[model samples]
Target chain A: MTARYLALYLPSLATDRIRRAEPGLPRSLPLATWEPFGNRRVLTAVDSAAADVGLRPGQALADAQAIAPDLLLRPADPAGDARALHALALWARRYTPLTAADPPDGLLLDITGCAHLLGGEAALLRDALVRLRQVGITTRGAVAGAAATGAALARARGDNPVVVSGIEAGVVAPLLLGPALRLPQAMLAELARLGLRRVHDLLGQPRGPLARRFGQDLLGRLDGVVGRRRVSIQPAIPPPDLAAIQDLLEPIITRTGIDAVLDRLLEDLCAGLRQAGLGARQITLTAWRVDGAVQEVAIGTGLAMRDPAHLRRLFAERLERLEPDLGFERMALEARATEPMAVAVQPSLAVGGRRDEAAMAVALAQLLDRLGQRLPVHRVAPVASHWPEHAVTAQDPHDVDPTVPPGWAAQPRPVLLLRRPAPLEVVIPLPDGPPSLLRLQGLAHRLHRVEGPLRLEPEWWRNRPNRFRRDYYQVELASGVRLWVCRTGLPGAPRWLLHGHLP
Target chain B: MPSAAPDVPLDQAAVLAALRARVTRLEGFGRAQHNLGAVPVCEGLPLPGGGLARAAVHEVLATTPGCGAAFCAVLLARTGGTILWIATGRDELMAWPPGLARCGLAPASLVIVRAERWPDALWAMEEALRCPAVTGALLALAPPPGGGKLDLTATRRLQLAAEAGGALGLVLRPDAACADHTAAVTRWRIGSLGAGHGLDDPRWQLELLRVRGGRPGGPWAVTWRAATGRLDLDKEATATGATRHAAG
Candidate 1:
């Protein structure tokens, strides 16, 4: 029931990103990335070499160049860094399903029940760091009882890697109030002016005075760090396991040009599924637009399948709905759900003239799949209920169900049943006989012949309200149009409604 | 036994005439087979075959709902393959499963496609006709709420698609659509005959308004036998404003 979190902070993300991308960059050389801040260019990130030369982030680039004259320089890519951080967060889903992107350069993962898989909390953190290091990304990680404290320890405390509660006070004693605590810089400056720079100084102060001075935000965050309050992290939805993503060099703006690229992605995804001996029952194509909006089109099959050609045909029907406004920058084809499937073996004897019976069946399934994606494709299945409203349902054409029979109620049901029954006006010929004329929808119909008043009652155990018990009639007008009408209530008091029309 | 590349142009006039004949044969497959290998329409229509062509488009201008959906349901049962009932939102009043079963369409053999627009409905019908598994595709073609009519070219495309896949295509449009020029092999206008009190057998005052190869004649009061699920032209059946005119 305990919540434990791990925060992974990439300190030199911008500089390290350039180094990792271009391995020829000398790591031993001092390096830093700078970006425009207000009017002047300031350092946004510094590598270990640059830090050792007494250079730091936020320092004027001219001053940093003066301090380490031979420093390697590159422009800071804030957007790319943010994207990489988000991707890393998604990649971290391997350790835990719950992971969030802490922007600027950090990630938070709720490794609660997931810690034991890689041995324990300490071993998991070590494995994570080692793996990211192999990818050439320097990462600092700390696991704590709270996300706030874990974030503070990983980015600001710089001490233990695994700090469960109770030991958090002694560990957090000397740590200064920093950006990771998410405190306003103005408030931190005010506290530092009162000589209360360390977390321990504020921890020992009177809660009432602090509340009066700084409002409740400072106390709420401090309690959150000490494990007194639990704050839940908004984790990103986990990406599908079996998927292929391609970032385009040029955004795709035309539907005509989409097929060549889609075919490649489907091939890649189907290959992965085939290797795992599984087939996708449900798959989705997610197009990330250049304008930062995402459009998703998904298809489902009656049976598990790994055929790229068949899937491509189905996707083509719906791809028209995916608007490439300003074009799509990246796309991913993912199998949202899969099922174990036997590997398909090619029949050695290939003969072709006309399509065979087996091929016809496949064609039928494919047709349903394609049509079902763009519109409502279903078979009308009979439900075993005496109630007219409960007698039928729209069912998927390919779904095999055991409950429904091919036919129900040997009595002829109407060919067209109105979704809502309309009230009918009846003028009976005699006191006991059926109606001779009727008015419906402002049209007066003279009855030519009237069939039986077949009485149907609700189930024995059910509450048979007056309207629930009905006397149904198949009536024919002089114009030869047939209608199914029902009369409820006793002979003394009758209510009529037009139910449906006969073919 | 000659190659499909057509006889070499020996005489320019002869070659041109031969190609014209070939084009007519290809273009009007339905007219060529209007008298042979047709799906029998119960008690023969006024046509020579007493039936309609199998792999061709037939338009029915339903004066009362033009053709009853029940008639199409019976055709689906007789075709003995996967059937598609394509309808737009306004015209999707059929497909009551038990009612379909009552009329003879197998429950497992039917799939309904609801199209949001008129073009999509036409596209779905064309797509269904092209699929080998679909033996029949019936489209309930109501005039789109926004004004758009089915043109001759669209009907021709459907005809070609039907010929390729060996599937039957039936289109039921409102009687108001009778003025549109269509490439269909036959166009029938069916009006509900106001008859006696007995409505068990829906009788229609049917008129074969047009046909490609045959003279169109009807206004024959035909009865749909519920028990046999067949169309019967009964002379003794009482009908209002119906003529017994017949043709072949």
Candidate 2:
């Protein structure tokens, strides 16, 4: 298939970059950016207001200041201009995936086979130019069969599309050779000195002489213009395989309007995912504002999901956070990360109702997604340890347990383990026996019945050795409350603390 | 609330039929006694539908320190399905995994939701209770210092959420006076009655303080029977102030 390309030229990019950053700057004032060249300062760029006053770029800064005494001048920022231009190119990916920055104020889009989504090619170019205009930028663009011809035409016949095919020669025969092919300034000057201004002048000449004179550069550019050689551009973004984009007829300013657009985009995106038998694990919603700014919000799910309703619910929680200043004209939804719908899950526990394990896992996942959105939800997995506090750890709800989990100790343990042990003032009637009474925080608790000390030695395999073996006593208070108290230190230097409570 | 049982003799078949009708009306058609699926507390205690009501909030207040958590563990185990144990804020009385395992609760089936604040905890509980995938939700809310109080509106919201999803809702507080205005289907005060005559099995005093639709019973002594994973109720052990002398 013959490639189609759209060249977007921003003639006033430098001045607009300054104005876009400080939007409140008066457009009535003539603006110019100046740069220091050795010992002299020269004007690098001038806005339309400054141009109207006959203040042109490349003129001495003092001369321009004299011509337009009210000219507003700022330091030239070439680096910032290139970065913003690249960002604009990345934003253009919403129109077509193959987009690249055509530096010093231009962008190129490989919109081949992508025109049908927004009607024919003509409508697409018109839509893009109008959207750029809304962002306070006046740009010119053109679409043609060849990237070389399209970029040259965008400069000369802005906003027009080359409608016919195989007439690339007829179209270029009338135009100057400098634009018909992207020749260097030196070559164009030399050709002009020889009185060869129009492409028609070169058409009658042999290819050997021009190839020798321009060192194959002129011939290669000529071949690219007439679609003889297929040249490639490095796209700013690789583009997502699955995405849905909407170019609004009128800028959407209200939440309801944005929501309606999102509904359509999600429907189309989810349908594509379902058709591919894949689900979106993470998705990004990008909104291109009329003021040339883009905002994006992302949502991630616990499991790969293609359910439009669920996705919509997740986005609804976050959409309110977006700032839709001056309204947005274009929106794109992309599945940034995806996975096959059948991700494996361990069906360790039986969920109630007459559903299979797979179906139960799906239900549980959805439930977890909904609950987890507002709060943290997790389960305890038994860690391989003998210490009661370190025996179990909090993990994701769906974490699979070992096929054969560690066996429980022969003796009973507390149901609730305190993160920190609570100290108790013990009054032991017997030196080697359980405490007769326990005092905690000025409250007195007398024991009703006591069980013997169950000695638990610390795991010596650990780097830190346990200095004292824990002597645990399951004692019942007179109120019939069970407490698991531990004598943590040696008998001579005993430190008593309540470790856990039994149900 | 010592209301009398029906004077008319209940034949075996007639009682079974009555139970089936009640279960069908409360839950749906053909659901066994396992599914408006109440906590299977041993008989003699006055629980709505012969056990603590499911799909409705039940307040389990600890008159004694550890008794409430013990009773809640048993309820969480027998009430059925995926359980969510929520500890509101930092002053939570979380049941350790090993201890709850002793009560027959499989750690695999339980989810522990830890919230940073009281409102968040209630919100989490309501969300869990509303999901049909969760069969039971237990919120451990401490009073005053670290935890916030659950007003009538909060409990009502939780009750409505539980009703919508058909999951058992349990709220364990530290005291009987914790919530003056409660919308719970039943209010149970659990206290320890000491180790039963020194056999290593500790007995708890289960008092049915209030019931919405059913008459209140119990102040009954029940021991945790590990082998059966159920409470063993002692018919003759319903004495009040039994621990008063031992308190000194």
Counted clashes in each candidate structure: 6, 8
Candidate 1 positional error at A161, Å: 10
> What is the alpha-carbon interface RMSD for each candidate?
2.6, 2.0
lDDT of 2 by residue, A322-430 (tens): 7887798889999988988764432333344423555556666777776676677888787777777667788877675633255753367777766788888989997
Q: What are the models' TM-scores?
A: 0.66, 0.69
Model 1 lDDT on a 0 to 1 scale: 0.77
Superposition TM-score, candidate 1 onto the true structure = 0.66
Which ten contiguous residues of candidate 2 chain B have the minimum total lDDT?
B28-37
lDDT of 2: 0.78
Docking class of 2: medium
**Sliding window of 10 residues with minimal summed lDDT for model 1 chain A:** A342-351
lDDT of 2 by residue, B96-127 (tens): 77777777778888888778777788878888
List the RMSD of every prediction in angstroms: 12.9, 8.2
Output per-candidate TM-scores for chain A, rounded to 2 decimals.
Answer: 0.57, 0.64
